[model samples]
Target chain A: MMPEKVTIADVARRANVSRQTVSNVLNSPDLVREETRERVRQAVEELGYRVNQAARRMRTGRSRLLAVRIEQTQDGMNVFDRFLHGLTESAAKAGYRVILYSADDDRSEIATFDDLLGAYEPDAFVLTGTHYGDVRTSWLAERGLAFVTFGRPWGMPEGGDHPWVDVDGAAGTAAATRHLLDAGHRRIGFIGWPEGSGVGDDRRSGWVRALGEDAEDSEAGVLERRTDGSAAEGEAAARELIAAGATALVCVSDSVALGAMQAGPVPVIGFDDTPVAAAIGLTSLSQPLSEAAVRCVRVLTRLLEDDSPDKPDHVLLRPSLVIRRTA
Target chain B: MMPEKVTIADVARRANVSRQTVSNVLNSPDLVREETRERVRQAVEELGYRVNQAARRMRTGRSRLLAVRIEQTQDGMNVFDRFLHGLTESAAKAGYRVILYSADDDRSEIATFDDLLGAYEPDAFVLTGTHYGDVRTSWLAERGLAFVTFGRPWGMPEGGDHPWVDVDGAAGTAAATRHLLDAGHRRIGFIGWPEGSGVGDDRRSGWVRALGEDAEDSEAGVLERRTDGSAAEGEAAARELIAAGATALVCVSDSVALGAMQAGPVPVIGFDDTPVAAAIGLTSLSQPLSEAAVRCVRVLTRLLEDDSPDKPDHVLLRPSLVIRRTA
Candidate 1:
């Protein structure tokens, strides 16, 4: 956070020493008398010295910068754009500036983290795109760096010791499934990305759970199809599912849902509720992205401030479905 | 930019003075002789000095931060998202961290600029969304602030004495209109936003230019419709144009073009080549945002470095047309 600057005179007055002693204690701690140096350090702490006050140079590092990676934009996706706007708004409210860095993968992200630490010494990092066994979290934890993620640690229960925020994909898909089931569609087909990724698996489970005991999950599995996340793939898969007697569909993303809707309009629902979904009137689920971004910043601010006992370690928010003509 | 750390010993050697002298000159310049102080200041200048250096305490304000406002995301628009990603990428490559700030209007933007200057002392500002008689540019200029804009200052040719990089909306719309004219559509209609904004007016001019003298300007003027930028508005306008004997349509934005395409399929061409356009096979124009962002950062970086007489003060880039089934 942008902690206010504590002037040399303020620190000197607090320590009952001259301004020169405070300057000496900062630029050259060795020149000050032993007792005076200790008194000056305490005064600096009590005064809330921030900004590049690491002029306790090489000690008490604070730069009021919050670092996060800006991923390259993907076709048919604007989720990151919404999240960044909310994040920058939230971070600014807390008096912290967010600095962006780029990386192609986890390895490079860690390397970039190392570079940022040496150059800007950002106060903390806000990580996104969390997955199982993500090394970025462990790397920061091992270094004892103050950081928080915008995604839950996939393999761990509630991000273990670190803090995180996640939008519940299962909750979204389950809602979509129930919506179709209530409309008298017994055989609701689920179209999603190939399994293995945490998000893919999480969304697939929702459809299965919503189908309940009457709908058989083991009957040839013809109502389920896992494919790449593209409109073409979605259209192909939907055609096959329709041939298999499916009367409704739940898609993992708007892109897929767009294609699925074109494959004969069988009450298709999508996730992420992108602009395309709104423009075309596709029923879809939307993540509470603004809320998630605010929570991510607030939680990290508390961690950096060492405000204990009250802050929760993790937050899991539900996704809401926006109904339109397609459903 | 990120200038490297220069230790006291390095400054001492450069000034041919003892390390203690350099320390005294930095922490308490009053204790050092007048000539020695000048010599130290010269040494500080002759070599690269990073931010948070001793010169900072001497009021030579340098924080190596580049401030830019991040606007809230708008429905059916991803143009800013592409531009920001490019700007941050280019800025980081030039060794500057971009800090985000927000304001609802010009007055608040100026106020935010004042607040940022006091807190972070950002090295410079990069402005966007420039419009007719935009007061922000003059405000920054009056203070002798180092800044650049991503939009040309409307009402001023080539942004006058200031530096700017703008996408040529006229060039883009002209290309779109020519594409339709080449297809033998003599009665081509144009749908755009209500006039006043430089971008809207510029785009409208292109369609007029492409029609040439053969298209009567004094007729009913039924070949053109200016409406709000939305798909529904576009469709309504397209319907009117079609009923008035228009054979094809050119839209100012993809959102409007999408609606026009639905108003009875007359080979629609839209601007911004958005994901929705690609998904539905709508022909459109797309700005070279990455190139524009790079030029903006490069020009600003040169300005910060005081490398004048070489860097161009203005850059205007052309948009490319992407053909699909619609055209």
Candidate 2:
């Protein structure tokens, strides 16, 4: 059960004034006579009249609420928290508030969007964790809804105009690979997610680009294994790679690198440089998620306000390798 | 460069009707005749009229927004994310939306609360991560704001009426200690934050309660070391406790337990059972945070609606010990 909402009419009736007078008192208090203002204020206090945002939106046309979907992950190492921090901070700087919507999967996410649009009508939305065949992108795009994603539309046809800003996964692995190569470890092994994972494949391509054809052929020279990015899985994969004569490891995530640490003294490099990496002193690549979040908000703001000097449809940012004791 | 808001008057003028008729078209469309409805709909489409929540709030007092503060931690292993997940899921089930406010410290947080109250006027607030000497509690309480905290108002004087839901931290460590004891471990050590940390002291008390006074007297028998709960610091403290003849360890957090893991395989227990714990297979205590979140939202909803059966001022929850390979 909810409280009884005391509307402006209630305040007006209590103050013995017209509804327009009460509206003027709220929107432009100075425009009303001092005695009228005092009477309206007293009535509001007596009735506990709080301005309803639904009524306010009918006049202002702006909810001033930015909606962002957060998908809960089994792994607590999710970077969305940082991304959210960046988004809220930036949104607040622009005089907008953020609404957090939780959707476990695509269907629920579409429902969330529908519910938000029908009820709250957020000014705009920011999407995260986009992948190939992500239907959410198309859902918003078809509706002509203003939104910006933290990940690029991976499988979209070239020159599609959906706005997005993404950290270059390949660039991250390429940097890690080059770092390992520069360390004079030619027999480098890579641990990542199973193939066909868009992000994972991009990261693997970076390693192959660094190691040449030998890194491509599973039987030729590249020592590679894929798992679910768990520490135990990483350990098992690392042992196999080590037995195959790899002197260094390049993992897709800090979780895998942590597992690889158990496979001997071979140096390992990881991506995402999550808190786990800091705990164990593992060298890892840190995605510029905060910067990417800022970028996404900027693009969304532009799409919402339509006053920016220039709008970019997509942006790809490079990740920075944070060297620690691991590599 | 915001778009100009199309008003009810504009729609009415275009439809050659009174503003009240336009309102009727929106709120009670059935009251309008079919031809008038078609005319109003055409005017609305021609004018691109969107509902203004500000105007609607004057007629119906509901924003349906719940504000929650999210402080950005240095580490991505932020517990607030999990808390948000639970809060949003439950709030949505109740047909409410959540607004995320990001602030660095108490001052900014209070300012954020002020801004939101003046602007959107959310129905209620769910406070998380309360600390010693927190001023937000008093601030909100003094203003008679409808809110509930995720942490108990520790150190508050008797009969504090503000609602709060907190996990019994001592229960978590006590369970861990009892489990370790059952595993035939007599000499157990404690790794926690520095003295005077309310949560840390509570957890340490659980260990002392189980092990007796000798466990409280560092100079006599108990082996304890305090640090900033970093992996490196955990490693140093763990090594010292191990050198002092302790065979098992209970840490304040999973991060510390991770550092403790580096000090040899002595079966360390951690708090928070974070993703890192699952990845590394460290046995840890799992706070029923999701349940706690649901309870907090339920209480806050009651406070806001002012209609619930016998609302309590404080609710304490129990945590469970998750046994993993590390222990």
Candidate 3:
């Protein structure tokens, strides 16, 4: 059975310290002496002192809990899986736990956000896969809730007062294309998803940027192909690109590269550097997911703590090429 | 700023109803008159009524938060992602929120459980990937915590008190083997993980079981090969199995099946029917993960509700084969 509420004064008395020391121990442990911190902690534990969340909130106006939406793509790409793991590890180090929810779409996501806020009382939200004029950010921003996005607010200029972390897809694809170009391949084709997605287009741009300033046939979208981002479709697209005088290929996703690999042993580079690519020895670009996640949490904790005046608002991390047998 | 929590008494006074009626409206609306329920709900909404969790826990002991460990395999298998989605959906229906944590190993997982119990005060936990003499379960059991496993407690007897929902791996592999047998293939081979894991061995046993009940060469691991459950390793082992008279193969995982498919297009069946499997058209057994997740929550809720004596403590649901191009 839980005992009566053990106040900070009680823990302080038990530890033979001032109440402020106990407060510092709980709120900012680094501010307290190590020995005094241990003593206060032992006293708190022995006395079963638990934070009355409401009381603590009213006093310090600070807390730590983040709500994360866990999503899996229809094609079974585990892109978010690695991201979730990285975020969780980083969040734990920062004294936060993630309350996860899944929603069918953005509308339901806002609804779930409302439910989670009321039910779990998370201090902030970590939005993933953000897009242009994203409703979720606007919803939270309108309510004056603290939050950060793991994806760039597409079409929003740098330093738009929105906090986000994103991997530079164009840089990743450009690096991939450059690797192929350095290997003496002139006609490097790009395979990507339908042109509507900002991420897909970003990746396509890098491939074009890597080709010389000729930008002629490449400008015609000459050797480029788009698909629904399936391995089978990738195979077909790869075949078509190969037929059109392309000796090397750059794909927006590992799934397409997988299909492209089946099309021929011709050198190919895939994005995301997923486990599937590694297992099959495919050259690909590895997203800096872990670093990005760490930065996301860093930006978020900075906001919740409100200690820094010039808190970093946006992060665009570069992905690196993992040279393997395929390219 | 959050105001003081609006209690049931406050809502009752606002609604001009008895406190008992207000409690009934909150806990069991079915027991309250419709008109009375509407009045109490409206009053509660007007007052922004928020239950004092600690006080409510003392009175009813029927809280609803389930702690789930979010896990991602090193192989990029998203099996747990689907299971988590199913559990979240089902848990939401039952007014439960899942608090997710990820751990590196069983030891860290136990530490996370202790931390979660202290911080979240969840009513129960949903454990996945149970193994023989699992330390995690023993720790929970020792602490008298309520939990249900998504995996079976290996080596436990049929009527063991542990609550779990597990897909019948043996039956699943047996069905795959039988499908091949019905197609008139003899000397079918089995590819699985290096023989120690309970799940891997369970799948291997299914193939052995469906081998005409000969129980001779099958017992000797003849026509059977083991690998590290990777596609590259699977390919190498498949080649060996094919060389030694295996007309068809049953793989323990989709990754292995992906490898075996590269081994000369031999008829093959994989387990877990992952997204990769669907993308590549690998015939595989689909574990009824959603059904199992739903059942795990059901068992947990039943135990927590404690009104039903006939609680389904142990459940073994059979996995179904999804036929595709590979087979």
Q: List the residue pairs that clash in candidate 3.
A: none
Quote each prediction's TM-score.
0.83, 0.81, 0.89
Q: Summarize candidate 2's per-residue lDDT along A85-174 as a digit string, tens digits.
A: 888888888767899888888888988777677557788889887777888987887776778888877777764558888888888888
Off by over 4 Å in 2: A1-56, A213-222, A308-312, B1-56, B213-222, B306-311
List, residue by residue over B3-84, the lDDT tens digit for candidate 3.
Answer: 2446678899999999999988887899998998999999989987766544554354434678888785687754888888
Could you give candidate 2's per-residue lDDT for residues B1-327 as a string of tens digits?
Answer: 333557789999999999999989987999999999999999988887766545565456456778998777765544667878888888887767789888778888888777677568777788887777888887877776788888877677764557889889888888898888788887899999988778888888888777763344344235888999887899899999999988999999888888899999898999988777877788988888789888887787776665643546688999899999988
Please state the CAPRI-style docking class of candidate 1. Answer: acceptable
Candidate 1 positional error at A230, Å: 1.2
Judged by whole-model lDDT over C-alpha atoms, candidate 3 comes out at 0.82
The lDDT per prediction is 0.82, 0.81, 0.82
What fraction of the true interface does each of the listed models get right, in terms of native contacts kept?
0.32, 0.50, 0.25
Better of 1 and 3 by TM-score: 3
TM-score of 3: 0.89
Where does model 1 exceed 4 Å of error?
A: A1-60, A156-160, A213-220, A309-312, B1-60, B157-160, B213-221, B310-312
- Model 2, position B29, has a per-residue lDDT of 96
Question: A1-327 in candidate 1: lDDT tens per residue?
Answer: 342446778888999999888888876899988999999999988776533423432455566678989878778465877888889888889878788887889999998887677657788899988887899988887776888888777886453568888889988999998898789888889999987778888988888778764454445256989889998899999999999989999999998988898899689999999988988889999999899989988888888776554545788899999999999
Q: Score the docking of each candidate (DockQ).
A: 0.24, 0.29, 0.37
> Across residues A94-186, which tens digit of lDDT does each residue of candidate 3 receive?
888776778888999998877666545678889888766678877787676788898777776543457789999999988888788778888
